[model samples]
Target chain A: MTPAVAFQKTSRHFGAVRAVDAVDLEIKPGEFFAMLGPSGSGKTTCLRLIAGFEQPTSGSISIFGERAEGVPPYRRNVNTVFQDYALFPHLNVLDNVAYGLMVKGVGKDERHRAAEDALKLVQLPGYGGRKPSQLSGGQRQRVALARALVNKPKVLLLDEPLGALDLKLRESMQEELKQLQKALGITFVFVTHDQGEALSMADRVAVFNDGRIMQVGAPEEIYQRPASRFVADFVGSSNVLPPDFVQRYAGQHRWGSLRPEQIRVRSDTSGDGVAARVVSRHYLGAATKLSLDANGLRLHATLPSGTAVPEDGAHVMLTFNRDQLHLMEEQA
Target chain B: MRSDRSQSAPTGLKIAAAAGLAFLHLPILLIFVYAFTTEEKSYQWPPPGFTTQWFAVTWGRADVWQALGLSVQVAAISTGIALVLGTLCAAAVSQTRFFGREAISLLVILPIALPGIITGIALRSAFSLAEIPFSFWTIVLGHATFCVVVVYNNAVARFRRTSGSLIEASMDLGADGFQTFRHVILPNIGTALLAGGMLAFALSFDEVIVTTFTAGQQQTLPIWMLEELVRPRQRPVTNVVAMVVVLATLLPILAAYYLTREGDQIAGAGK
Candidate 1:
């Protein structure tokens, strides 16, 4: 099948700044894809390019086999749920959701019914009569989602849709959004800077940095086997052991990544492990994070909550499972 | 602590505020009082006596009626032109960027910023040079020059405050340009436009300096009132007309104030 969205060597430049540079991406139909990066990493720009809000400076973009570069957003069969809900304040919830159908010349009664159904899909039933101003942030977010979903576009682009919500609400919304995408079976292109959000929610994730895609793969692959130093450092905060460190520890001269949780720390200075001094300790409720110095090479290790944490400035035995040290390709 | 500080202003500041209010409103109160004065020729202490006959006299004057009609017509047409031109200008300046965009915005606001007499003299000379006859349209053109600024000021502020994502969301939801404008942009800026139009009407209705230069054969109410003030047949009659002018201008200004009082509450603001 043709990809739901494809970019051929896309590059969006603003004067001297390369907002999105030489990007070649293809998102499959019905896939929950995420473009993950820090701010200004071109993730949002790529989403906008798919939505036709921003045309590539030098590229050809296609949406489901249709040329999309010059196509206006209104003509594209893709809708966006903006970061700011962007609900029309003047319109009540029903009208805001029904707006797409109304503009498409759907009959008022039919559009109303469809809007009510869309509202129900977002679990906001009976909120039709209230204006957007009257709703809470989460409710408004749902209304925005309903507004976009009511259009029934083949692809949906969400720009950091959960950034403003509280942690609890954001977690719940993530689950709801994942379920919604599965039920609707529409291609979802989610942009976010939060790696946990990306890993937990996306089927396939693209890690972006400096206007370039560092790596793209399944969530487990991104977490377990990052392709580069940037991905390893950005995705899961893994302890990136240098080539020298790897050569000394694992008998190889390749850069390797060891997840913090995979590193075991024992308070006793015992045999069969590298001795390290605990520089600092932090209690994180579920785990204790320790900054360790193993002969001047700094590393981090997370000990689960039940594990006895050593006193600060104490020497400890640190051991890493041989299989857990994943090698990366890039030198930098 | 905050409520105590807010509720109890210093006594000196209170007196000063009362005095300032009195200073501003005493002149207006005098205008209202003199409208009912019996004296028809000259100023007097305590207005000599009060009467309602001047209102009837002012009502019967054909010149007053003609001037009122001209003023209303000019104000209405000017406000209509300002609403369209000013809104378009505001949209262009606020929504998009181009070379000299700031210069164009400054140019749009220049007429209202410059001294009125300078604008009046410049308009008079431009009209004569262009050989455009001074007619009802000339007065409207002159009024619209400044009236556009009023509408532009309000509309541009509102346009800046309104989130651009609303327009993007509209388009994302399958709305074309016009539909996005009508459904999203217009509703967000509607009150600002109405308030601007109201203020434009109020400004155009009582415009005197520009009208004096532009209205060669026409007499807008203010010009009529100006002439009546200089050479009076029944002085109280002019004050009665002044009272009407005050009310005419006051109602719309008040309405504009109330309409824009909650301007910060535009949807999606701070979202």
Candidate 2:
């Protein structure tokens, strides 16, 4: 089957700024894919390129095997759920949801019925009569999702759809969106700055930085074996050991990543481990995060809640399982 | 704390607000008071006596009717032309980026910013240079020059406030350009346009300086009233017509105010 969306060396530039630079991407049909990056990293620009709101400066795009570059968004068989929801304030919930069908010349009764069904899919039944302003932020988000889903497009582009919601609502909506993508089996292209959201929700994740794809892989692979220093630093909090530190520990002069949780702190200094001094300690509910100085290099360790942690300014031995230390391919 | 501060406004501030309102409205109240005065020839400290007969006399005057008719026609046509041209200009300025876009926006608003006499003299000379005779249409053309500024100001502000994502979302949902405008953009800016149109109508109706230069042989209500003031036949009648002008202009302005006061409530605003 043809890929849901493909970009061939797509680049979008605004004057001197390279918003998206030579990005070649393929989103598989029926896969939950995420373009994850920080702000100004071109993730949202990539989503807009797929939606045809933007034309690439020097590339070609195809959607479901059809040429999409320069094709107007109205003619594309795709829909977008904007970060702001963008629900029409003038229309009630039903009309807003049914807008796509109505524009396609669906009859009023049929379109309204379809809108109701879409609302039900988002678990917002009987909310068809309320104006968008009357609904809370989460409800508005659901309405935006319903509006996009009502069109039943082959590809759905979401630009930080849960970004405006509070943390609890965001978590719940993430689960709902994941389940919805599975049930619908449509290609979902989600763009977000939150790495945890991307890792937990996307089947395959593409990490973007400075207008380029840093790495793309399964979420587990991305977490377990980041390919670059940027990915290791951005994806999660990891103690990026220098090549000299790695050479001292594992006899390899390669940059390595050791997760904070993987570092074990021994109170007694009688061990064949790196001698370190605890510089500071933070008591989390279920864990204690320690900032340590080992041979003038700063490293962090997360000790489990039940472990007895030494006070700040105390010397300790820091040990890690040899297999838990992952080497990075990038020099810096 | 907010309620406490709001409830205890300073007495000096309260007196100042009342005095400000009285200063603004006392002249208008004087116009209303003199409209009922029986005196016809000269100014008086107070009304000699109140009478309802001048209203009957003012209603029967054909010249008054003719001036009122010309004023209404000029205002209506000028507002219609301003609405179309002003909205188009606003859309161009607010929705697109090009070289000299800011300059174009400044040119659109320049008529209202310059002194009215300068605009009038400029328009009068331009009309004469073009060999266009001053007629009722000339008055409308003059009124529309300033009226467009009113509508354009309101429309451009509203267009800026409306989120661009709404338009993008409309297109993403499969709406063509016209459909997006009709279903999304229009609704978002509908009240603003209405308010702008009303204000344009109000401005065009009472325009004196521009109309004086443009209307060579025409007598809109204000021009007629000006002539009547110079050579008095019934001073109270001019006052009655002034009352009529005040009501005509005041209603639309009040409506415009109420329409736009809640403008920030537009959908997806601040999102």
Candidate that would win on TM-score: 1
Q: What tens-digit string does per-residue lDDT give for candidate 1 at A1-332?
A: 89999999999998899999999999999999999999999999999999988999998999999998789999999999999999987899999999999999999999999999999999999999999989999999999999999989999999999999999999999999999999999999999999999999999999999899999999999999988889999998989889998887778899999999999998778688888999999999999999999998889999999978899999999998898899898863
Candidate 1 chain B minimal-lDDT segment of 10 residues: B262-271
Candidate 2 wrong stretches, greater than 4 Å? A249-252, B1-40, B43-60, B96-107, B129-132, B263-271
Clashes of each: 0, 0
Model 1 alpha-carbon miss at residue A16, Å:
1.3
In model 1, residue pairs whose N, Cα or C atoms come closer than 3 Å (at least 3 residues apart or on different chains), thus clashing, are none
| Tens digit per residue, CA lDDT, model 2, B1-271 | 4466547678999999999999999999999999999888976868889998889999999999999999899999998998899999998999889999999999998888888889899999999999999998888899988888888888898999888888989999889999998889888888888888887877777778998899888899888888899776688999998998888677877777888887532211110
lDDT of 1 at A293: 97
Q: Compared with the real two-chain complex, what DockQ does model 1 have?
A: 0.81
Error of 2 at B132 (Å): 4.1
lDDT of 1 by residue, B1-271 (tens): 4466557788999999999999999999889999998888886768878999998888898999999998899999999999999999999999998999999999998888887789889999999999999888889999999889988888999989888888888888889999988888888899998888887888888788888888888899888888888775698888888888888678877777778887542211110
- Model 1 lDDT, residue B191, Cα: 92
Task: Compute each candidate's TM-score over C-alphas.
Answer: 0.93, 0.91
